[model samples]
Target: MLISDSQKKILSLLADGEFHSGAELAEVLGVSRSAVWKQLNGLESLGVPHAAVSGKGYRLSRPIELLDGAKILDHLDEQHRAKISSLEIHDQIDSTNTYLSSLARQNAPSGSVCLAERQTAGKGRRGRQWISPYGSNILLSILWRFQHGPAAISALSLAIGVAVIRALRRLGIDKAGLKWPNDIYSEGKKLGGILIEVAGENEGPCYAVTGLGLNLFLPEEEAGAIDQPWTDLGRIAGGRPIGRNQLAGELIDQLLKVLTGFEQTGLAAYLDEWREYDCLCGESASVFIGAQQFDGTLEGIDAQGFLLMRDADDRLRAFASGEVSFRRAFP
Candidate 1:
């Protein structure tokens, strides 16, 4: 659901985690007190939790860092800045990937980016919903046109993972690791994920919408909605406040380099770098495909980005895609 401009304004005011009276919000926004009350109430539908006391007024459940387009653009290196055609910031959207994919079909220029403050229908790999709360995470997508077909860019997700880890490390969060095809983990808990969608023909030119979601902070109410173990930058940073705009800028800069170089080098250029952040390498894990499951020892990724698994019989097998569960080494 799209939010009103007033709602967006109120959110920005409340982002610092300070309480504000309805009268104060109205005075600041040039709206009536009743209008401010209604807007605050509407935020609940958008998954934003807040507290309203008899005397203290309203405040968000937690402090948040909202993305700023100007800050992100200002942080980009000259070369990276040149690669972008346009950058859009939205208060609410169904999904950044969905928005970009549609634009790609309409011949949107390469290097176009879309960032949303909240995603009502964010997506995850294998058809799972990507839970995102207002102003609490990085929800972004970049559309890049490639000369090669889908097959040529199959390992793109793996390469994107490398970029994400590089960005994290740049910010001093060194514990994050790559989880095979498309996840970022810290101490076995998910910190973020990527979802890539391709468009165009089979033989020649194609376009990719690389979507990313990184958690900055997860409120208690939002945490309960996730099924798997998860950790945000807040926990990773040991309660230190992270700058959402700065992080978003770093992600865009690193990913632009990855996407631009990927066409010429494929995943080969990133293999060694990716290995450094391998999360499941040298571990025991289970792979799930459909209703079938196989237990194997994780042996890291192959040159082509396929997962290499050593089974009980000491035979090596490669898989291109599967749901993986890391566990204790098999006996």
Candidate 2:
């Protein structure tokens, strides 16, 4: 069974460095002492550490450092506060996007966030496997129901990329950049990727699930499994492992802020910001489009979110979504 509301309340009360006697807590919460004890036991079963002092009643061994949904909600500006309906955290899951999609199918409210500490079967664009080890990365998804058609949702991933870069910059890593479509990078190594999945018609109301997978403290062994060059926040932050909970909160905050604007303006409004941080701009690169590949100088993305590249013939072409890959040119 899931933890009860009273148990969650007890956990919240003990989140800080305060202790409450059984009688005191019961009186404050309008419950019986026995009820409080039962809830405490439930928390223990859920792996939350606590000390039962004879006189002091209960005290957490360490402050609970999980992301506080209430705190995040309180921090949001008035415009975004109304859209958020719920924030759910899980210790482990197959995929946050998949989990949230189930709720979306049931008509779950927009701005619902689903986060997991670990994802055993995380996925990326084109069904690529997303590496998600336990307690080492942030795996989360946000549900945004849109009134726009599916065509307008093409730039959703780009918008999310902008949000991620902004959030990382706010966390003091100002060098973060965006790779077209979805990847985030710093100094050429990948920091994260975004995957946007739509669950509606092309011309009807659509539900977009924006998923993010960010590396925080990737294990050496786990990192080796990645075929491409990758990086984590620990290295970028000067060897300090960033707090996952703190990063998660910042990510949600930035995503919510950007998403609110995206709902109104589509992707055209964020083109300038996205271009400013695009790492591939002015670099010679190649993009694979199915059986053919185009090698050219990376110009930048247009207002419509298509990649603008100047081919060898000095002709510019716009490339839409596909199995496109990026590589640096050697002199």
Candidate 3:
């Protein structure tokens, strides 16, 4: 559903979790009381929780920290802020990755970043839908150009995963860890995910769009479609308040730093950190590549970022790309 500017204004007005009467809302929105009522009702279609009372006006079920480009930029230092070529904050979109990819094709600068408060068709790993409700979580994508070829940056996604951990660590969240290939986990539950799309010459320059979808205040109503056990930063932080804008800025800073230097350092600089947060080092998980599935003990990734595993026959093998699914402990 496309959220109109008036709907966005209404959401902003009620984002404080405090009620605003019809007359008050109408006055601020410069619309009639009935138009204000219509806008409020439209929020329900976007899965924005709101309530109204006879005595009071309307308020969201909870306060939402909407994406603000200025606030995010404020959290960054002058160096990093200057490095960003452009920052776009969308009220809603299909997918930030797709959005930036188009811009990249149009010769968008390397440090261009895209953030959305909600994604109607968010992309996920292995062709899955990334379910994110309006004003519920962080949806970020960064566009960066690389001097190295695809092979040289084979482990780029894992390196980005390490950057994600660093950003979370900056928030005093030490519970976060990596579930290899490209997932962020905390307390054995999925916390976030990463997707990197690259396009360029075979051995020349390339540009990659790195997308991150992290859970913050995920409502149960919008999470029913998710198949795996999941936890948001709210739960991982032990119900403590997290500064969404600050977190966004931190993520951009860390991820861009990695992207900028990735060509010179490759993955060597990031390999150790990735190993430190490797959650499935010795876990027996199911790895799927297309129609085939391999059940084995994950032995961590190799220097080139290939996933290493020991299969049932005690044979060691490496996979360049696939889906990793955590299996339950044997009985």
Candidate 4:
């Protein structure tokens, strides 16, 4: 659901995590006290928790760092700023990737980007749901047109994983690593994921909408929907302050750098870094493609970013696409 002006105003005020009286909130929003109460009551729908003290009125359950375009751009290198043709931030949207893909169809420039605080219809690989509590994670997508089409960037998603880990390391969160084909793992739990959608002629010009959903602070309420082990920076930072804006900025910078060089070099430019951060290079895992499952020991990724698994029969097999689950968590 798109946020209304009044809702934005109230949220901005309450974002300080300080209680404000109902009268003060109502006066600031030019609405009645009853209206303020209704809006506060509505926060739960957005997955935003709040506390309503008997005398203190209301405040968010915890402090939050809302996405700010200026703060994010301040983290971008000046030389790379020009590379971003269009940029936007939405208070709410169905999906950043879906929105950016629409712009790509309209001939949007190569560096167009779209981000949202919440995704009502976020997507994930193999038709799964990617969920994020409002303003609690990074939901972003970038559109880049490739001259050589799909094959040119066969390992693009893997390259994106490298970029993500690089950003995390820069922010002093060095343990985050990559799970082949696309998930981000740290200490055996998922921290985020990458999903790339490319379209156009197989051999001609095409465009890709590279989407990233990262958990900075996945509230317990939001975590209930997830079926597997997952984590967030709130846990990884280990009491160190987690800065949302800083990480988003670093991701944009690293992604642009990777994209700027990828067409000329493909995954070759990122292979070394990707390997350095590989989380399942030699792990036991299960690969599921439809009803069939293959039990194997992972042997890392190939040059094109495909999964290389040693089947139970001891024969090495490369899989282009499938869902993989580690036989056991590894730290």
Candidate 1 stretches with Cα past 4 Å from truth are 53-56, 329-331
Cα lDDT tens digits, model 1, 1-331, are: 6788898889889988999998889998999989998998898888787899879889998777778889998868999999999999988899999999988888899999999988888999888888877887899999999997999999999999999998888889998999988999988889999999997789899999999999887777777878888889988899876688999999999999999989999999999998999988988899998998988899999999999999999999899999999885322
Name every residue pair that clashes in candidate 3: none
- Residue 54 shift from truth in candidate 4, angstroms: 2.2
Candidate 4 lowest-lDDT run of ten: 1-10
- For all the candidates, what are their Cα RMSDs to the real structure? 2.1, 6.9, 1.7, 1.3
lDDT of 4 by residue, 172-245 (tens): 99879999889999889999999999999999999999999999989877889888889998899996887788
The TM-score of candidate 2 is 0.77
lDDT of 3 at 158: 92
Residues 167-206 of candidate 3: C-alpha lDDT, one tens digit per residue: 9999999988998799998867889999999999879988
Q: Report the CA-based lDDT of candidate 2 relative to the real structure.
A: 0.79
**TM-score ranking, best first:** 4, 3, 1, 2
Better of 1 and 3 by lDDT: 1
Task: Give lDDT: candidate 2, residue 306.
Answer: 88
Residue-level lDDT for 286 in candidate 2: 78
TM-score of each: 0.95, 0.77, 0.96, 0.97
lDDT scores for all predictions? 0.90, 0.79, 0.89, 0.88
Relative to the true structure, candidate 1 reaches a TM of: 0.95
